[model samples]
Target: MEYLILAIIGLASGIVGALVGLGGGVILVPATLFIGINLGMIDGITPQTVVGLSVVMMIFIGLASTLSYMKSKTIDYRSSLIFFAGSIPGTLLGAYVNKGLDLPSFNLYFGILLIILSTLLLVRKYLKPVEWFVKHGKKRSFTDATGETFVFGYPVWFALVLTFGVGFASGLFGIGGGSIIVPAMILLFLFPPHVAVGTSMFMVLLSAVVNSITHISLGNVPWLYTIPVIPAAYMGAKIGAALNQKMKSETLVFALRIILLLLGVRSIIDGIWG
Candidate 1:
């Protein structure tokens, strides 16, 4: 019965994750806690265990999502490769560091990071308009506007540095790395929103895979929970990628931001009350 409940939560999370670039962390973590409580796993250390399990599950989710995007030709493989170059090592290091940290500290830091991510999502729309004006300057057909053109707008070295930081946080917090990578890609690398989402998903695939290994090494993941969620997440990703191509840019961004804010708030409240 508990597994059934978790599977349902996974199904809902998978759908939301597909629509947004989040790897279902916002849904998975809280759901895990709820299930853990019901299953008598709600010891003081349950949150950390939940995070570990979620990160492990995100590996499969990211891979499944990336495959769907890849089939649609939405993935920017070159950029993903560049991001992964830095992220792989960072994930390992983060996993090692996390293995030594206490659960309460991890929860506190995770909560703080979610709050920061929520603020970033909330402000992205306003910032984008300003950035669009600054970059395009009333010309929509500028080099940046050409959908066919791809450029590494940021210094490659700087982007690599940022990728490492983002990946480390992802590993530590059980996130998709999209929350950090998408904004960086848009603001720093000048990727279009859709491309940023696609590229970030690909990058997340690599980061999650690397991070999952670390979690496994630590014996922190719950396979019983993960096995049933993978296929549902994959299906969600397929539907999401298709929907993404049809949505207007402004509408998608607006919706994503609102969702992020609500999820973040819910997560914070759950953390406080749980």
Candidate 2:
């Protein structure tokens, strides 16, 4: 029964992660904690174990989504490499930092992070790209299937610093870092939305690999539980990538915002009162 629930969670997370380029850890980690620990449905669940499992799932999820995006030609390889340069070390740092967190503290901080991410989703459309980043940084362009062209870029140094922070968040929280990266790409670097999503997934894939290795070394992963999650997430990612190309996601995103907000509040309450 626990395995079944985990599979379902993996499917949902994969779809959402692929749709938004989040690498699915945002949904995967929270759901696992709520169900396995908060609800007492599974044994031996801890924040560290949950993070480890989520990062492991991300390895497959990121691969699936990144491969899908590759066929679309939306990824920026050069920028992704630059982003990776900084993210690797940042991920290592975050993994070390995560070892010190207790359940209540982890819940509190994770809740805060979720709220911030939810708020970003809520207001992202209304925010314009930062002209300074676009104007002063390097320039690059992409031509989409519709023959529409987008010009965008940032300084290599800035990208490195930005992705470093993103990697830290990913390793600390066991997320893909797309919640922050996607927004920065669109709002700071003026990347085309599709390109941002694709590139962010690529970065997520790279960071997750390093994050997983770090967690494994720490002995945090619960290998048995991952059996059901990996395949389900991989399949769901394919579905999500297809959906991303076929339909509008405004309504789904709005729903996701509300879900994130509620989950964040719940986590905060649990942290304080449980």
Candidate 3:
């Protein structure tokens, strides 16, 4: 039964993560904590354990989504490498920071993070792209499947700084960092939405590898739970990537925002009460 629940969590997280380029850790981490600690359905759970598991699961989710995006030719390889340069070290620092957080503190912080992410998603469509970053930075062009050409770029220095912060949050919170990265790419860098999502997954894959290794070394991962989660998430990622190409996601985004908001509130309440 526990394995089944884990699998469902992985599947749902993978689909949402790949579709939105958030790497699914937001879903995985919160769900795991709710089931194991809040609800008392599973044993030996902790903030550290759930975080480690989420990062480990992201390895598979990132790989699957990145591969799917590769076929679509939406991934910006050059940008991905640049983002990695900063994110790698940021993740290392974040993993160390995670060790210091107890459950109540983790819940409070994580809840705040979720609310922030939810607000970002809510405001994203209404925000205009910042032209300063695009005009001042190096430029690149992409022609999509529909033969529409789009150009986008960002200052290298600024990108490094942004991704470093994103990585730190990922390592500290066990999120994929896409919640912040995707919006930055689209609004600040003028990236096409598809390209941003694809490239973000590539970055997620790279950062997850580093973060998961760091968590494993700290003995935070619960291997048993991962057994059921990994494969499910991988398959779900494929489906999500396909869905991204085929449909409008406005309604889905709205639903996701509501879910995040509720989760954030509950987490905050639990943190305060406990």
Top of the candidates by lDDT:
3
Candidate 2 lDDT trough over 10 residues, lowest sum: 247-256
TM-scores, all models, native as reference: 0.82, 0.93, 0.93
Which TM-score value belongs to model 1?
0.82
**Sequence-dependent TM-score of model 3:** 0.93
> Once superposed on the true structure, which residue ranges of model 1 sit more than 4 Å away at CA?
38-45, 100-104, 128-152, 270-273
RMSD to the hidden true structure, all candidates? 4.4, 1.9, 1.9
Model 2 over residues 53-104: C-alpha lDDT tens digits? 9999988988999899999887898888898888888899998999998888
Per-model tally of clashing residue pairs: 0, 0, 0
Clashes of 3: 0
Cα-based lDDT at residue 242, candidate 3: 87
Q: On residues 1-274, what C-alpha lDDT tens digit does candidate 1 reach at each position?
A: 6566567666766666655666766667665665566355534336556667667667666776777777656677777888889888777777777666554455456656766766775676566433432343212211223355544444556667888888787777677677767766665555677777777777777777778778888887876767666666666666776677677656656766666566556555545654
Predictions in order: lDDT: 0.66, 0.84, 0.87
How good is model 2 by TM-score? 0.93
